[model samples]
Target: MVTEVRGFTDPQKEEYFRKRFRDEEQASRIISHIKKARSLHIMCHIPVFCWITATVLEDVLETREGGQLPQTLTEMYIHFLVVQAKVKKVKYDGGAETDPHWSPESRKMIKSLGKLAFDQLQKGNLIFYESDLTECGIDIRAASVYSGVFTQIFKEERGLYQDKVFCFIHLSVQEFLAALHVHLTFINSGLNLLEEQQTSSQTEEHFYQSAVNKALQSPNGHLDLFLRFLLGFSLQTNQTLLRGLLTQTGSSSLTNQETVQYIKMELSENLSAEKSINLIHCLNELNDRSLVEEIQQHRTSGSLSTGKLSPAQCSALVFILLSSEEDLDEFDFKKYSASEEALLRMLPVVKASNKALLSSCNVSEEGCEKLLSAVSSQSCSLRELDLSTNSLKASAVKLLSAAVESPHAKLNVLRLNICELSEGNCEALSSVLSSQSSSLTELDLSIRKLQDSGVKRLSAGLQRLNCKLNTLRLSGCNLSERSCEALCSVLSSQCSSLRELDLSNSDLQDSGVKLLSAGLKSSQCAVETLSLSGCLITEEGCTSLASALSSNPSHLRELDLSYNHPGDSGMKLLSAGLKEPGWRLDTLRSRMFPEGPGGSSVASLLFAAGPPPVCCDLHRPSPTLLISAVSAPWGLVP
Candidate 1:
């Protein structure tokens, strides 16, 4: 009945010198596996700079610490460079070189580490979680172990990715500034690169060479290397990647809007009208949901209206308006009229193919209804229909009722934001929301005059709705505790598939928050993100929230409570929950405090450090708070 000893032995567990050569080999295998997993995470990000940076850093650290480099260095390095080469091929003009040959030393490192790591994986003896906190506050995670080197290196590489992306944007801004010099000092500099190219009357290669030479002769007025690089990229790239870089680089500097404008104009000047149109279309095609969302947030209605877009850019605008339907429920349409005419003109082109585009055209009931009906009859692919600021009386609600119930309804997004709808309309819209035809994913009813009675009317309809409606925004909806109770009841019921709920700018205080939290505690709530900005709740409300978050919980990953003025006390209360491992919060972004010195706003306090593993961002008000505030457990200062 005696069990055979098979696991790691005491000799292997002892100090490096105490272990046999076999034990050392076993430990190395474990380290190697961890390095491979870490490498996957790093390789996911493109442009091998991060990997290169990590390798160089590892080399530097090895030099300083007088230790051997990790066994998997060569494999990680090659994988990193391969990613860079791939991204470069797609992003850079003239394409990137491949099959780069590493040195013999590198090859040897790869062969040695690859075999060792593979053997460990095959043996199934790797420890994925190898660190824990010691008695002192300092985390004792993998910092001293041999594998700790690669883990440290991976973190540094990830950090390098962030820094490099940030620096790339900054360098782009500098290039824009260099281009701006053309408008200031260089406009009449007697030497224009474009003009020089046009009139040189020399061989194309020689002329371009001279132009590059002249461009780089002096930094005083010359474009920086980044700009030169950008020009080269645009000249040799295909339509898609070029357009992506143009949109990204152009939009990076929102503060320097004028500079961005100039750069776009300069780039456009070199292209034909057709190409410019396609470029604008490509910008509209930016399908990276995250980046587009960031842009939508920063660029508001007023700003968009004032921004200049040529006739060719209109189709792109139409596309954005169309795609916006997917989440029109969250938008505040009143803020987006930017030259109503420009928006109106694109509607027809967008609606040309939809027979249901202009349904429910009863102008007598409400202006919004008439517009909705008129568009319903058209044969256009109308994805988003914005009627936020209009009086969408009972008639408009009824129009939507039909569209939502019809199985063939093409409408996926319907925005009724800021509409002054009555209780009757709410009930009617509830039917629409519950209908099988509605493919709505996002619905923003913020700033609507919906009272408790309205919510009560719609609760049943919401519970029965089968649409994949993940994001629900109801900011400033005049919801009371009673309304919250009813809503919570629905959420705890069968309709528990929601992912995000934004209840900002509402009248709900601690009582409402408590009720919502209680409902969320139910097993039926599958929400992943929540927002309660400007709810006027106190620190005590946060205590209730913390309690709910720390409890055996749901899938919540992000929670935002911006503009709530909860102060330090409320923040501390939330921090308590964050310190607990039970809490599943990942992105806790908020802008709660006032701006600090150098115009740094207090919103940056949300990401400030405390005792938990979290990212503190105090940059909204100013990044200076990280310097001046008392450092907390989250790693951010107040």
Candidate 2:
């Protein structure tokens, strides 16, 4: 008992054009032209726009020159109007339709339909009852002509509960017709209905200012396109297409310039993101890309960093980023201005990108609320987000974590390294890692003060069966032996999925390494890469690690013991495990600090564990085998 209808997707849009033209080359030509005007191609998602575009382009391509084809939305609507009028003449008079020859009767009917559209549009009514039409002074019988070519006026087949109702094929058509009526009334009588309170002043500025204000006041922005169409009428080009319907086709060029300035200045005001984007669209409709072009100039010149971008320029940058065909990749905030406001204005850009690097911009708490929408957006392609060096509050972290735990989240990698993370933030992220819906596989919370408490909280999540994390980085978290106990539990658990662990630059002295060795020896441990660089380890710590390698060396493929004072005694113990009969560790990475005397002997003997034959020369130490860089897997010690 329920029915659903939706607009065309990209494939469906192409399919409609292919089916309508029935010529691959012809359809491709029309498609190519629309694609160049990105805004027009976006609108083709609607079936009604596609139909109207086909109608206008079909004749334009055949008769009109290259630049004569409609580029903006308003121009396209105007051409559709002229085409529909000419079709009416041909269908009834059986005459060769050279141009639109509007009879008095046809003009009267169209004008009446316009009034009906304006009246219904104000009340936000898409469907009209029989009484609604009569109230607008529209003769029900005369309205049927629009059904033939205009595609909508009275769709009697929509028998909702056996009652006659009327509506446009699309809401945009109604808005366009309504705007047409307003333009006609204004150019003819200098009357302005857009103004809530009528003023004696009839300046062009007053008319457009009132329209913009009214559009901004609407809660859901229902009047945005209507405002675009209304302002677009000021241009002489859009007006010429409706010359037959207008009392006068001529418009003052000064008035057009004034309207453009008024709307462009509104961009400097503190408007919502939605309002800013709509204002940009209105500028496009007015054929004013001066602001956008100016920003493009500054961007290309590489002088954007030398000066602060104004709010108008910032919005234009957002518009330019979104308008490009190169979406669905990555958005790096550093490429644009480092201003937080400008970065936040680019939510739509982030929504389309698969990866986003928003590091070090110092996003505020309120900004995190804005980012929550993008993080949780089901339609967004965002898979990886790096918020490194952004000092986020615990409350902001909670909001982001909740989104990461949502079923709609597609986020796979989150890097919060050097983010001033706290225990409270760790608790929030722990929930995300434990969530069944979470897709997070890699996490970096490096260079913070998580200590023992944060690691314990995180260990709970890592031990959960639903946790998807395989790579975890906790470098410079100020960890100690207490932290090791909690992580050891996670490493030995059957539910843990941890494969790569980084504890570099933490103060996990000999005691911590012993507890970690207990976890490493467990048969359930799946860790392939373990980094313990700059952990203040000693010979005692190396002894426990040797036993762990001897007990279980099948899983550990990479061991990093760079920057530690493992003396001759520790190297003697470690070499026994590395040379065990069932040894499988191929990537042996160790950096030993000499103790007392004969430390060089210990360094040369340490290579006996697993280095290649070239690196195993005891007489000369190979530079390739003595890597101390904890930045990555830098070298191989045998």
Candidate 3:
């Protein structure tokens, strides 16, 4: 069972084997046997011809240095590869397999010997078993030197075909390396969006250890280089692993300032602020009170108070710190004690940066007011404002609207989500938006009770505003089909440059979706990403959406109909469009039951269900729209 095979190198021996393989109709038998051999730590399913060539070379090396080969074929394979890359006119011969450098028969015999050796190793899973090459008649000193050179060669060709067996234990020949290679290629090339499979901390640690082992084994005395490579790979594969650890584990691994700097240096190129935000959420879960104390205790705490903040909390605080106005009454005065003062002192650095965080902070009304006052200075350098989920009512909007016209209005984003804005606040905000001096790029008005009337008033300003507003979120604004029509009309007109729209959880039915679909057909419309999650849509709406998508397939990049009741018929309609190669829609899924695994099947089930009350007419647009052009004729313009 533990047979060491020597590959046949003689032309006659090759012919015999080839003829025998042909007779048996086994084109891959020999290569398969070699791969199944357990001596190789890294298995690359090379072409059969390559394997034959490798077998010949491995045989020649063994004969020249009789009974003196590395213990693990992993070590010997690496040694052989180095020899192949460096040497020319390799010669070997056995009576059965021959090469010019050895007798034809001698080369054949050596090749057979090599095959037998590999087979023997495979039978026993010898690579995992063997550690000391000296016991196996290998020159340890020479093998060690050869390993260094071999590692260098391996690194140079790391891109060709990775030895993933060492990287992941689950790798099997059943799994296609080329397919995985293509995936990693796509990711490295940045051609497609790739999401990492979420894994638990223990799993990640296990994988990390494996990665370390692989890197260490990659080359001799190049552990640092291997570590650097692993770091880059880990970031690419699932940077969240590192970020999650930092967040959930607190500041244990990164307590040393040097270590923090090293992590920052390692991740600086690709660690985005968004990743930082996730880190912050994790850190927030960990008690940052110690960090708070640490900040208070430090002499130069101002410059390093941020050190008290984990990478995640620091990322989250970017919003709180930069947007806090000097005159605001809401921000806890106590919070402003030492750390806040230190952050304010660093305002110059913050203001100079282009990054801004858009999130809802659940601070009290007084805290919001205090925050506004603090940031409401001539010297205040707030570039973006997000008062979403705060009590920024009509009065607050009116006051902030003045800041929109201020000479130092560095504001490019404003979020007023769930701020309970009525028509009065809508009008006030719209007036500021319509102003010639407005520098806003994104505005979020979700869950703000923007009924038909308030929406209608805002529509007027939207039509007049010349600013480059790209994203508008009005989810749960009590918008009926008519309100969607109004927004659709604005989006369809020349006045809109909106690239993203989120009407999620808006209670809109098929009629609203249809109205919006028709608007998308208009040549002037530029909306690219659309989210209608939780909207009540039926099969009819899917048909309408398919038509809209067909009208302009290139513009849309992402569309989310998640949580919508689009049953089988609707899913079929959408799937037809999604399968199109020209359409920019990269992801599509739905949740009809709100409990089942969300997928196309669920989407189909949702639409198969009857249309909601808002789509009572099924054919007619909802009556909520003040604009009349959308309802007439009963169908979208083709």
Candidate 4:
């Protein structure tokens, strides 16, 4: 059987908690104060959160006369951390007076635990084993003595082999410990060696500059939240609480000043939007209200023009503006200026954004090279890219193909339509399509000059076992019968993953259709949609298509033979295939011939089998004709 526990507001539960405090009045005051903080009050609904709140509030009440209490999540955690430290130190000293910060054993345990946490966090592992603790110089026996600190933030579990496994209670707790490790390591090092070599102010400056550089160098944003916590811990109030718990020195004015300058310099040098946004968060934690306001003002003042700002500067400006808004996904570059600077600024945005649109941006080979370089970075997050209507050539295509092949790239949709591609471009693109790491699923190369040789190269890629391209658009690329033959081989191959093929408005004729039909008849062909619009196919080609359509368990669902002269004889053969029990073709479209016996007879035969379960469009007289079998069926009659 299962039982449900009542919430904090339950009278019996409230009475029980009130007794845990010194008096009922103290409990009431603490509860009243927490209720004033809207966010904190909601968190109190969790029993663990309520317990932490009560503990911190009780300490604040006992320590001084009307002292300021923790109001935010970070402040509350810091207070709880200090309380745990004091309790642990008292137990370790066995009733003797001792400073926790100065205790050798306490310092050793903190350092060891912090190092273990930092290393595991980098590996993206939250759970640890007995071996991991031993490797970090942490004895299992000592870990039990520090159970109060560890148990508050980490949960210990028994493994199947009777060994111990440990994980943080929350991810934020791990981040906090990692930040504390960096801070104490630097400050402790400075006190030991730098103080003898230079003044205390100089040592503090060195510590701040070193820490800032270390945090900024991490491109993956792994150190983001940790850096923010480090800055927050630099506050005087937080430092006071940590004085005897972790550190002996107060917060340094020099460290704060140096940190601000170092961060600004790093922001100006790097063009990553993710890194810049993290730096801003750290600045907020430092409580430098003026610097944050100045950066925001600079972005909104419109002084940072595409032509005037450098790439790094433009990236910083754009990131600052975008982070101020709530829904970043809605931000578009529709009206953005088509300049090198603008494209460069978008590089960082593309690396962090899920969708990127740079259509009609007048991008050239140089811009393509830079953009590809950004996409191939270790921190790239782009999944879709649109460079349509650009002027990319073979060199740009090669660069882009290399980027797509990078293991770090996550691009799934790529559109380079009307980009002036050539046979050489196709060769480069084919290499990307064949790469095992390539993530491309949709490719558009329409309206460019990719003749027989280009299509042949792309077909070679399609036949590769590793190629996973599902949708391909190669319309109006001057392809011939030879190109169709190459694509036919891809469809006939058992390893092919191609699903949709569009060869519309090309130079292909009846011979090309006949060649494609041979592959379509193969059981290995998985294509579902085939568009051969305006390929000059005649009745002879339709006979071959009919044979393929009647093959056992056909995969074709939609066929377009429109804008071609596939006369009455062609329709009769296609109608016969539609009547076959094994045929899966559901939609067929063909252009209307002149008003003769051929046109009427073909139309009647299409519906002769009691209006077959397929939608057929035979355009006649008007170009915009609608003969509906399904809902909202409209067709173009050319």
Candidate 5:
């Protein structure tokens, strides 16, 4: 789908103006003005946009003494129309600068062109024939003048058979002109082209409401930009720029605010991400930034953590993240609010993020349905998902299991910790991991009560050659040696890809340690980090571990034995194992012993195992290994 048709660079744009304009200072001044306006500068990249900018900015800068200047898209297009008319008048009609730009004849021509633009745009037809022009009341003779006055705006070309066909210079030009046509039709004659039904009391609010409805109903969002321009034209300053086209300018400010309010309310509805983002754009065009500004203020002051956000603010925050160009490496759901409604409202962020952190958010089964859509979607960027602590049940996780088993999904890391899983949930997870399509490398099921039965189910997946899991965390899972027996099978299997295993805070006594050490000595064991901290292990466990390390301990780099009953005797076994020159243990975390000579000798021996073997002081409260599984802040677009 990609083509070599990228727009002009900044230097190319400046060079374009310099070549078009005879006076270099004037060209420099115009480039300076375009640079000041970020949107305008970005638009100048397109070659046709450069022409439109040249036409619009040249006149506006010269008439710098104007009553009001153009800023929004609606205002700029309005000025573009007026400037085209004025140029035609002076060049061909010998009119002065002070001449009334919108003569009756000029209005006729522009209105006809607007009608053509609107009608053709509605039909999704960018190119039209002469017959199509006549339908919009543009005779062949008037079309000549149309091509002459705004040749670039309304272009003429030959078809395959050498017959003449026509289209606007760009699709954006057609959309802008169509929006102007809709706005002027409503303003001058009170005709609602969007809807066939006319209410008894059709205020500016209803007309705009109809326009919004029509745009939202378009399946492909064909009228999205047109709707933005149409709504933006409701602003009073933009109306002033359209003075030549308007016959009525007395729209009440109260009614405009009502329309803005209506748009914000629409934002809170359960709309698709694309529609929600477009509605936010419409709100911006109306100059209503109250919701957006409030969210920004909350995020800036760290007050979002303290207060609850309304539905509208949640949509605004989503708009900020979805529309940003920054590399949103993470989307933290709980960072905003833990409300289930907020999580559901912002599910679109999951599809947009490289890694989404939705753990600990007050998510529901319905939220899982929404999350499933995002994850299974073919174009989503989500690779890592942390859905921990939402307290979801088996049925909810089964829904997520569907996405995890899909070949198209790119999910690589999944954290379902503390989600209240049963044996059935583990069965579903086991199937997902066993699927050859699954790409998950790290699975964190920590803090769950998946007992021996559940661990047996997961062991089926760990033994599958198709399963590619490298890090498996079952910390605080109420496991016993029976569960460790199942894991021992997995660790000894050459098919197991597990390099890191966290079985911390378990009831795995010496029996479990011995079971695990037996697997660690397997030539196929790839585990580099093993965390058995707080497990009920004493001297007997230490003897087994030391003997296992003495035999084949090259694969085991770091071992955690903290907060256990591994007394002085166990320490001596560990110290003896450390003194062995065969193994290369990088980090060893054991209990902090008392200050007796016997305890000091064991401690110093374990520490001073002469080439300064890697060790860890279990005293410093295990440097928070994870970053709350939540990070990467968002901001409001300026």
Candidate 6:
């Protein structure tokens, strides 16, 4: 039913080449040149990779008569780096006193900048102050005037307090520099060892141990991408490019082998899979097809189990599996063990997924806390979450409230039915609903034993000017007249967005119904559908509702008062309202309305062009009337 393009096809590829290379002849020739490398051609499927490929190939064709095209991602990036450096050098030579070639001065400056990038990156700082430049032995004024390699990668911007701030043009560029700093550190250590007459293997082993230890010590995983880039740089083809631009002393092959061996050892030691997945990506960069294939085989065989994995590892396996699938509809956690570790692992997948269904998944307060942390981190992609029928109590609900208030949270639909929420939990939930950053639009708090006080707190949040909620379900929450008063305030507020409200199977009596009628009569009320089924309403409530319905431009469209004893008098009051010229209500439901001498008159007024009323059996309970004005002249009973 659907066509897939493994790589850019025909006109798309041709158009891409034409746009990237302005010269038609050069574009055709470059395309022909890269066609010899199948791996590079396949990578061109991604638009960014295609741009990098075109940039590298164009440089090679222009600068050298018969330069070989880069075949791998690492090789292409390395070539692109060289091209960028050369371009900067050319521009600098025309306007500055310094030599443009890879001289000792330029190499020293590069080393200083790399150190600065690495230090700042480790601290999770992407933007740097002027003091950061001074600490790195960089003269900002001079660098800005000369427009050298520093200016090419690092850009300057005006700051709020300080006059100037600097950051890498892209995070990837900063990552590359951080990795380069590590490689240079290893090279300097090797050079010092050689002066002491130590063997090359010993120096490499030390470097490998040092790099791996440093990477493993970062609990926040800040060094993971840097280590990956460092491994990529260890490749011979990539190192060759670096050698031409920076000073180097020893062979990188030993370092590469040792690094790979250290990673394998770590993986064999049962390290967390989620934390070690980046190592897999590093191996892919090294073109280690055999190891990648082995990992793939393990994944396909389902050899990994929850018992063998840490929460982090479970997260990694789920990510790998989801990436391989074409469509990820749902990740059922029911198949896994009900351990806390298993649930923790599922959190990452839940954060990354669009919709998650965790009904009866045995999640506890600890799991809820973990999921909340993920959501608050601003990295989670979850839009809908269903935690119905869980054992979560008020404490867990409090923990979840922090996530709901997060500005970065994307959740729009949340179901927390029967989660043992109480009055205390309602306070926390109220803060979430009232938050300006909240994205919640549909919420279900059904059958949670939220009594009158709980609904009162929830009503305060619903009345907030910033609340965006449109549909609310509070069935069987033990509400009363006091709760109805608070809800009326929400419905009467000009800023309220409420469209549908369900208070079905509650304890709201005739007084509560009269109070709600005031809200329905308000000019600001936008509610279109209302359900007060089994709420113990009587003729007095129906009279109040009839008065509200007679108001001009009422928004009420569907009303359900089913399973209640509205009586003949109540039916007559409702019938009078139905005959109002301004009344727009189209559907109404009620049960057990007593038939009397005036019943026919009430029925004729309610359904003007309908047939005679059906008789109700005394032994059998009459079905509730569900009036649909557009479809039939009279109410339909089923």
Best model per TM-score: 2
Residue lDDT tens for model 1, 1-638: 32332322223222322232245554454334333333222222322323343444344343345433332223333233333333334343244343333333322322322222222222332221212112212133322321232222112112333421001112222232233222111112323333434442333333333433344343342333323332222222221222221222212223223322333443334332223323332232221123234435535544554554444344344445443323222323233334333333344443533322222222234444434453454233456665556555676578766755555445666667766678898788777667665666667787787888988887767788474666777877878778778878766776645788888767688898889888777777778888887676777678777777766354777777765556676766665455456667655555443434465433333334211333343322231322112333333445
State which candidate, 2 or 6, has the greater TM-score: 2
For model 3, the local distance difference test gives: 0.47
Tens-place lDDT digits, model 6, residues 1-638: 22333446435666898898898888887776555443455446566567767777887887776777675556776677666666666665453423445656566666776877888887789988778878877778844642335564667778897577788766666777777876776676543211234444455666555656677777877777676677677777777777756566454676667667777667555344345565656655665645645445766676553445543345445545444423344655654445656666556577667777777877778778877787766656778888888988778988888888887788888899877888998899889888988899989998778988999999889988889999999987878888899999988998889999999777687899889889988989999888887677778888888888877346877777755557777765665555555766766665433332334423223223433343222111223323321322344332
Best by lDDT: 2
Off by over 4 Å in 2: 1-32, 42-52, 65-67, 91-95, 99-121, 125-135, 138-149, 152-166, 198-201, 377-379, 406-408, 492-495, 517-526, 537-557, 565-586, 591-638
Clashes of each: 46, 2, 71, 0, 0, 1
Candidate 2 per-residue C-alpha lDDT over 1-638 given as tens digits, one digit per residue, 9 for 90 to 100: 22334467667878889899977888898877787776787788788899889989997877675656788999988877777777777887676767456777668767777888889989989988768888978656655555544454335444647766778877888898898887787777778877666554587667777888889888888898999899888898777777777768635778778878888888888776667888998999888888888988988898776556677887888888777656458888887767777766777778768899999978889987888777797756689999999989888899999989878778999999999788888888889999998999999999889989999999999999999999999988889999999999999999999999999878788999999999999999999888887687789998898888888878877777766666667755655545554766655556543332333333223324322232221111222333332221224332
lDDT of 4: 0.69
Clashes of 3: 71
Which 10 consecutive positions of candidate 3 have the poorest summed lDDT? 165-174
Query: What does candidate 5 score on TM?
Result: 0.71
Taking all chains together, the TM-score of candidate 3 against the true structure is 0.40
Regions of candidate 1 where Cα sits further than 4 Å from its true position: 1-348, 352-380, 465-467, 565-569, 593-638
Clashing pairs in 2: 610-638, 611-638
The C-alpha lDDT values of all candidates are: 0.46, 0.78, 0.47, 0.69, 0.78, 0.69
Q: Which residues of candidate 5, in runs, are more than 4 Å off?
A: 1-177, 198-201, 216-223, 239-254, 264-277, 298-303, 319-330, 349-356, 378-383, 405-410, 434-437, 463-466, 547-552, 567-570, 574-582, 592-638
RMSD of each: 24.9, 6.2, 23.8, 10.9, 9.7, 10.1
Assess the local accuracy of residue 476 in candidate 4 as a C-alpha lDDT between 0 and 100: 71
TM-scores of the candidates are 0.40, 0.82, 0.40, 0.63, 0.71, 0.68
Name the candidate, 4 or 6, with the larger lDDT value: 4
Q: Give per-residue CA lDDT, model 3, range 1-638, as digits (tens).
A: 22333333223333544554553433244433333332221222223333433454345444564443332222333334334323322321122323232333322322332232223322323231122333433344433333343332111112234421111111121011112222233333432211244333323333433433333343332222223222222322222322211212222232323323333333223233333322222222221223323433442345432234343234434433332222232232123222332333333323433432323444444444444444444444566665666656566677777767555566777878878678888788778667776777788898767887787777777777474678888877878788877887777778777898888776678988888898888777788888887777778888888898888777876677665666667766666565567776655544333333333323333334432222211111222211111221222231
Determine the C-alpha RMSD for candidate 1 after optimal superposition of all C-alphas.
24.9
Task: Judge candidate 5 against the unseen true structure and give its global Cα lDDT, from 0 to 1.
Answer: 0.78
RMSD of 6: 10.1
